[model samples]
Target chain A: MNNRMILAAVAAALVAAAAPAAQAKDWTHVKVGIEGAFPPWNALDPQGNLTGLDVDLIKDLCTRAKVECDLQAGEWSAMIPSLNAGKFDLIMTLGINEKRKQVVDFTVPYASGVASFIVEKDGPLAKMPMTGEKLDLNDKEKADPVMKSIGEMLSGKAVGVVQSTSHEQLITAYFGKDVTLRTYKNSGERDLDLKAGRIDAGFDSGVYGATLPSKPGNEDLTIVGPQLKGAMLATEVAIGMRKGETELKEKLDAAIKSAAADGVIKTLSVKWSKLDLTPTF
Target chain B: MDFPFLYETFLTLIAALPLTLQLAATAIAFGAILALGLALCRISGILPLDWFARLYIFIFRGSPLLVQIFLIYYGLGQFREVRHSMFWFILRDPYWCAVIALMLNTAAYAAEIIRGGLLSVPHGQVEAARSCGMSPFMVFRRITLPLAVRQALPAYSNEMISMVKATSLASIITIMEVTGVAAKLISETFRAIEVFVVAGFIYLAINFVLTRLVAFVEYRLSPHMRQPAPLSAATVAGEIR
Candidate 1:
């Protein structure tokens, strides 16, 4: 009876020791996923190390949240599924949209951007009318004529956009019928196609599109057409989490709010993207 | 379970079939010619010709098809001379670039198959043909070529099926084949499994038809291999008695 009581006490002590660690709200360690190919956001540097705005922001956010972060690189296509499968606790550099919301929850947007088109400097599309205007895709009254003009200009021409992106959705919605759409797995490949003249124009984030023309071999490429916004093209860039992970989401959201409040996001944005993309809300 | 969505997905995937078939058919057709030439070079007595063929096969068959496609499509495009030259006209189009890559890759594998087939032709049959007073060309045409083709058919059919599937990679370079369309659908609906299931069905259907066609060709090519029909049950019982 004494031996039994001692065994029971030991078991109780072990359970007591393990329970709090499992139930603790403090996420001491986290696995975060980011598409390392997305430059100026999250990308690998010369020595094959992850570096960019998303990398920097996640580091700061994790530091402030008192959590150890293990940043992982993953393909954009695999992000949601992998997150849901518990491969990672959070995904950064995700664009918040209704379609994605159905599969994963998003933290408060840390940044926002518009989509635009890049074409060769001497290409036929260089003379397009709306070079710098920001057009809302949701405003049908404003968008129709602009879309029609774009369709006319790009008829029978091939346009490239990154696969599984808001840019692809916007291009498909607006000009899918008139122009040929080519979707690439990454922006680098799409940019390569653009420089090769295989694609007449490339549509993607205005910030990303701006970086392409300045590339060494891509000097001939230039950003043309209107800066596309609203609807599918305008999206709030945020971190993605599995559905029902409200605790992690809230924790990250708090970190983001603090980062924005302290201008950390703005500073990182300017450092990486060379523009201010700080979210107002 | 969503019959309407599956049907819609099927229809969308079907629209991309023509491009997929074109890539596969063009690659296989061109690859067969290149393979025949390479196989001949490999078997030729000259050291340089055989060495060139062996090295060509080694490099192409050594690398993954995706890497080859990327090198041809993107890597070559990086050169200013390539962009400025007349080859840009062909390289500038992703479709042609994919076709070229698929052809080159398939030709390497097919060359080995063809060479094996060529070597497998019975020496007795060639000797008999020559003894019958046939010229070298006539002997090759009448005996060696037919038997070698028959020997290579089964393996070549597998190669054909592989080429058909390989067309899916063209989507990576932005050609909207069946897989590309399915990927787009998945992106829109965020339902990867359903879209991919439909796309898989389409590929299965295509491969099934190709398999049947190859079987028919095999049947027609080998008349001597045909067997007599089986007797009916009653006839078999009566004969047993």
Candidate 2:
């Protein structure tokens, strides 16, 4: 063959060899990624297998979706990158947000969430206004007063958070100038500082926050202030995958919808978090 | 290339560079002093002192720097005595806690470097200094210290660069160093590769300048090792005349 024709034929052969892998994707076999350290949602058992709400729910969703899925536990920071790199077909417990949307598409939210503060039980911050109350941040009229009061109280105080979380954004948006912010790589690391009194308070998800006090030796930590949702804080979490994986997304979306309708999420939520995390709509 | 994003991230990250430099400088400076004492302990013929220094070096070098940082920052405060003690004011601050950890960790490694430098000073040179009517202190001050420092500078410079990199760990405790800001940016943007590339460049630039400065110091210190400067043409002509 002439040189030009030879090059064209080689390129065509390469494309032909790649097209089947792209076009004939199978949904029956799937791989799911999850963060095993985020408690109540997911964590490793003593025997070192992943367990908890996300694990249990994923099993339900995969059954309903009719996919025999293999679950992988990994670092939270690696989730989006790994999924887009094709290491995973889905990532669990990803809170839906605008920034993440640019990189990975999300399944329908399967769990509703909230944010709150935890402080040493003996600290003055433990007596914050609206303790044991629910404050919907979207209702600015009611939230504004409480937000102002919490801000003023926390002024010049250091607050700790796990970096990059939705509640971290909410804390910066509401109390950026008021509180000294300390971002950590993970919750366990941040919790140590909070216990040491290096940080005056810690902001975390309500699921995480409410559960902290009950952990042994965390008796001195009290979850105070309102369970907060809306604004920069994400109120719902979902499975995420690369954008345009339409077939897999549809399969997950349908499974999640049915799981919610059948009360699977509510049952798992109460079992794991000791609270109802069922998404409203 | 997202030049704008990189430029903005650089600005944000550079704002924290002063803190990074401060952490490294304080740790290196204080660590040098501690390391000198530890090195002397090893060379001093006293058995107890030598063993103490050996034990100190072994403990610090064996453990991870991150664990040491956490222990000093958080582990110490666990006891009520630490909180109530007069030293609590310094221990309570994250900045000081990081400095203490970095200093202690560097001292262990730098001690060996200093010890090697000190040992390399020939016994004949010391005897010569002593015979020159110089007092013991004067001999060490004028001859031994200078030669030992020159011997140590190359290895010590590596320790200093590593110390600079170690300052990134201070971010875990809330000091707004370069790595801390880069981490926050990554979390906000979810653009790990881009932000990481920018952060890596910043460290490379810092260490580049640091390496050059160390080379300059070594050049000045080892003037005897340099080839003599070439005479100008007029000077050569005068010599010929």
Which one wins on lDDT? 2
lDDT for A19 in candidate 1 is 31
Superposition error at B68 for model 1 (Å): 1.1
TM-score, each model?
A: 0.87, 0.90
- lDDT tens digits by residue: candidate 1, A174-220: 77778888888888888888887788988888877766666577788
Task: Compose the digit string of candidate 2's lDDT tens values, residues A120-239.
Answer: 999989889998888988899999999999999999999998776777888888988888888876677788778877899998878987788788877888889998887767668989
Mark the regions of model 1 whose C-alpha exceeds 4 Å error after superposition: A1-26, A138-144, B1-7, B228-241
Candidate 1, B1-241: lDDT as tens digits:
4566789999999999999999999999999999999999999889999999999999999999999999999999989899999889999888999999999999999999999999999999999999999999999889988899888999999999999999999988878899988887876676677799999999999999999999999888998888966889999999999
lDDT of 2 by residue, B64-156 (tens): 999999899889988879888999899989999999999999999999999999899999999998998899889888988899999999999
* Best candidate (score: DockQ): 2
Clashing residue pairs for model 2: none
Name the DockQ score for candidate 1.
0.34
Enumerate the candidates' DockQ scores in order. 0.34, 0.38
Candidate 2 CAPRI-style tier: acceptable
TM-score of 2: 0.90
